[model samples]
Target: MARLADYFIVVGYDHEKPGSGEGLGKIIQRFPQKDWDDTPFPQGIELFCQPGGWQLSRERKQPTFFVVVLTDIDSDRHYCSCLTFYEAEINLQGTKKEEIEGEAKVSGLIQPAEVFAPKSLVLVSRLYYPEIFRACLGLIYTVYVDSLNVSLESLIANLCACLVPAAGGSQKLFSLGAGDRQLIQTPLHDSLPITGTSVALLFQQLGMSFLPFSMSSCRSL
Candidate 1:
């Protein structure tokens, strides 16, 4: 099965730089950012982090979710990204905080307190399935927080396995197993009338010269 997501990214702020722009935050981690005719990485990061620390602001107390759609200039195909932004702060020692705060740059050194920063995890795909990707991210987040050694790339890969697409639809829509067949019974009220073109095509395939007839004509026959 192929992966639902083309790329998975985690973005976080660099507390040292307090101003706006790309330098304010950096891509903490990402899986597979190589060899694309028009990579969505730059635009994706810009959409999420351009204003700087917006995800971590007080307005976003709850988990924030948004979608970004961009057309690949080369292929002229659209790529969508489902992003979830929330607080994912790393605990740091006072000494580490001092180092990260860059005491050398500051006028006078002072004890640093615990830092809280906004982090965003994004999943990019060719299709738009926000609910599916959101659910997948929930599992990925659980695995991420629970295990320190867990690989993000592996997590995304496993997520793709669970969210594989089936004939352009989500796997959740399919209930059949391997070699299994499902009989779909439709009520006449719900069924659509067969068009003359369809009947003509069928007759042509069967090498029959039968002309198309309506239900009323058949009744009279």
Candidate 2:
């Protein structure tokens, strides 16, 4: 449920503060990232069951949900995500636990790569781990695994820093072949006789390059 956003790009800075006023601080002076204790559950969000109707049945772990909030150092800006976990199980006769305990087995599914993320969570949560997303994310944090001690801001900042490229890096590869074309050139290999009117006369015959007959002399032409 994380957008993996980095707030540093939007944070306060030094030069902006000095120019504003006599006693004011930099406009972009500090970052927005924080740890969980310092950042509280963003207060007063109403939660309800999924609309229209709801049904509950799980072969394994209980359904879990959380609301996360990310904020800046000054608490000026905020972002949030809703995260939920689910189990994935299928009723298959051959795939039962006893049949595959010591045997080599393989399973396959036909779907797009986009579906793998969601399906993977279901697959793991249904059979092996009940809390697949939280469990996997827990391995990432060396301290306080699954305690949710990390603030939404810090989580977003770190995730974005890992996945997103910096602003100017994207254009580097595309510009490598630039300047290969000759925009303004004179032919050093050719011999040419030039007169001011002679150059104009040549393309005029071709008709594509020259727009003749001025409006000032329209009737005469």
- Against the true structure, whose lDDT is highest? 1
lDDT of 1 at 127: 50
- Over 4 Å off in model 1, which ranges? 1-3, 16-23, 37-44, 49-60, 74-111, 148-151, 160-221
Q: Model 1 TM-score? A: 0.52
Structural similarity to truth (TM-score) of each candidate: 0.52, 0.18
The reply for model 2, stretches above 4 Å from the true place, is 1-38, 43-77, 83-85, 89-221
State, as a TM-score between 0 and 1, how close model 2 is to the true structure: 0.18
Per-residue CA lDDT of candidate 1, range 14-76, in tens? 666655553466677777756344445446464443343343343334555666666666664
Cα-based lDDT for every prediction: 0.50, 0.27
- For model 1, state the Cα shift of residue 151 in Å: 5.1
lDDT of 2: 0.27
Tens-digit lDDT track of model 2 for 41-67: 332221211211122223333434332
Structure candidate 1, residue pairs in collision:
none
Judged by TM-score, which candidate is best?
A: 1
